[model samples]
Target: MKNKKEMAKEIIALVGGESNIDSLIHCATRLRFTLKDQSVAQKSELGKLPGVLTVVETAGQFQVVVGNTVGEIYKEIMEQTSLGEGESSDKGSRRSKGSFLEKAIDVVSSIFSPIIGVLAGAGIIKGILLILTQLELLQKTTGTYQILNAASDSVFYFLPVVLAITAAKKFGANQMVSVIVGLSLLYPGLVTFMASGEPITFLSIPVLSGTYASTVIPSILAVWVLSHLERLLTRIIPDVLKLLLVPAISLSVIVPLTLLIFGPFGIYVGNGVSSLYNSMYELSPLIAGLFVGGGWTILVMFGLHKVLVPIGLNDIATLGSTTIFAFAAPANLAQSGAALAVAVKLKNKEMKSVATTASLAASLGITEPAIYGFNLKYKLPMIVAVISA
Candidate 1:
């Protein structure tokens, strides 16, 4: 295989050179690029690259699918270019102005993508710790176990702060000020007061008491508001005092509003979305299972699959476990099994090799390579995979 640096250079050249790129970021799997001229990138050529699994264009990004090695590729890509500034404006871009759903997906994906690895790691540790404690292999009361448990829980506990910083970047808000707001949510005094169960009142209006830790919606919504407020403050505040006043004024206005309005509103929104999903699942477990299982790959094809991540995470945060990801387990099995079948039947050596590798990758729970690289290329296999799912 080519070194990552070489692959990065080739990929860069294929994506209309470095100059066409407005911003570049990598999720767990794909290298997401916001290009100045989308038309200039050679999508097909990029997909044909040795290390690349496929190329996907959706959610306002020229997404190059590199599978799990995307982080290493991203590092190489960064080293090769000066596109690390992370300027995400669409100024002079050819893509249409995004709809609300599109914008929301972009924001959500951007915020979650970078931190997902850490989140998953923390979750794994928590799961392992739970299992060990239940089995009596590890005593939960031990100092070692407590320290490890804290490590596992820290990510969720500080989720709002991380989300604040990431969302601020995505929404063009002041990052530090947004972080300050996030920090305020978890302030020791506030936590203490909240734990006391005493009523909180601002201007004689009672504050709804809720823990912001491990919640997704509140910080994201808060940052979205902060982005708009920052823009307004920047325009009105004088140049000399602009930096100082903008952050101060934005925080002063937003922090109170977040505690009073946005925080509870976001929780309500999460509950509503969760409720709708639960209602759907309850209405027809079989059909819902079939639809999610059968069309899982199709959803990923259109970039709609990411909508489930937050839902699943939210469910875990609120309800301790999720039903959503259960459907995906079967989907992965069906697709990988089909890919393996195709690999066994294929005549071409190259096709057979790719199919075999993709099949193994899919069985290991990374299905993009198999789905995009093997199944989709031979339409019959992809169809059979969906049917089998």
Candidate 2:
């Protein structure tokens, strides 16, 4: 019955208060804790907290599983403990004392954690469409297929909006400013420049050019920079004019700066990654596919897949399309096959239930549960699939 905030306070108290903690981090479902003393930390006590699902002491860290809302719980804990007190007066100061990695991870987690459900749900729906289309049952030209594709693809097509909101939250900038920056990418002039194919000139500045649809690095980086600039603008300006003038000042500064710096920088980074991927492809398509598809699965299992998702998106945007999608497709298929294999082979009720769920999740292109839950538990088969693929 207790709220996440209430439970966060209790966990902070149990972990010898906020001061005893050297650092804290979190994954999709767990609060990874590094404390001054593992013995005094009392993982058992923290595990008993209402919101906590489980406790994992692994690799010299005490991980408290808070399910999907770990970020919200973390925010409450930080607020109650004044964890970011020294970093920023309003918020984000709690782990100001924590290491750079802690802060970076926290920022990343905060941005993606809230939107993960939507991402997974959309991805699942898209996966179903892919399966249906590939099976020759649902023609892409059909009205039903078109409508379903549109419904599923909306998140990806307008991904900048989602990133804008989350990035604003993470950067402590005004949501509207972040949104404005995202909008700039879709501006008429920008599109006109792309249409003309005559070298993008940002205010006649000859800006670097690349499509931004489904882009990750550019928008995220732009928003991050804008968030900081917005903070500075918000810090200044008269109190009487804070509301209206702040946004105006931020957009004036950020939009121009975004075109000049972040936009080009993102384009370059995205292009660089794409080039690197292609250079490897020149070595061998089979190698590239294996690396992308099979290697990617391994990375996703450990939550390292996010690093590549941006790169893959960047490739698709800068270049026309990608084989990375092909790579990703196989991992899903392999997980699905492995899960189905388990469902057929296993008779235990609990095991059957787990396998059934895993099979469905994997079939829908969500292999993490299979990778981390069932596949990783039964190590040999996971190894075999990854190797054969």
Candidate 3:
């Protein structure tokens, strides 16, 4: 395989040079680029490059598939370029790049991508804890179990804080200020007060503070609003006072606004979405299964699969298990099977090798390689996989 830096340099050139890049971010397996001119990207050449699995353009990102080495490749690219993380230079081109929903999906994927591994680890630990307690092998109250449980639970419990930092970056807010806002929501004293079931007031006005931990929508909305408020304050506040005064004014206004408005609004919105999904599930689970099974990989193709992650996480946190991942599991397996079949049928040695690798990756729970690299590009196999799913 080529050196990561060599690969990065070639990839950058193939995507119409560093100048063509509007913004760049990476998920577990792909480097997503918002390019100034999508037509300039040499997608076929990029796919053929050493160490690259495939190239996909969807959800407003010119994505280069690099498998496990994506992080290193991303790091190398950043080291070689003036475009720092969370900083975009192609504002003029971005406005015309994609639809609002596509842009929204891009933002969501970028925000959640960095934290997925740890979140998955926490979820796995939570599952193990449940099994141990259920099997009576370990008591939940024991200090050993308690500590391990905290390890499993802490990620979700303080999810708002995690989301805050990432969301702030995506929304172009001050990350430190966003962290402060997140911490304020999860302040120990506030949590205690909410636990005590006491009526809450902030500055003599009634405040509706509740659990902010393990929630997604509220923190994202709060940070978005905070970003605008911060910008406004930055403009009006004197430069001499900007650093100190801006944060003070922003946080003071934001914290109360969040408590009175965004926090409860998010809770209600989340509840409504969960309830609606549950209702759909109840109406006809088989139909729901078929719907997700047939459409899940397609959803993934457009990067819309990320929308399900928070919902699945919330479901696991709230109900102890999730139906979303379960529904998609068969789809993943189907893609694996289809890719393997294609590997056997293909004549070219290189294509066969790539297909085989993708099949293996998909079987092990990473399907992007198989889906984007081969299956989705070939209409028949994609249809077959969806039907099998």
Top TM-score: which candidate number? 3
Task: Show pairs that collide, candidate 2.
Answer: 83-94, 84-93, 84-94, 293-327
lDDT of each structure? 0.81, 0.68, 0.83
Model 2 CA deviation exceeding 4 Å by range: 1-149, 197-210, 345-347
Model 2, 117-151: lDDT tens per residue? 66667766887998998999899999999898888
User: What is the number of residue pairs that collide in model 2?
Assistant: 4
For model 1, residues 172-219, the per-residue Cα lDDT tens digits are 777788899999889999988988999998889899998887788888
Candidate 1's TM-score reads: 0.88
The clash count for each model shown is 0, 4, 0
If scored against the real structure, what TM-score would every candidate get?
0.88, 0.72, 0.89
lDDT of 1: 0.81
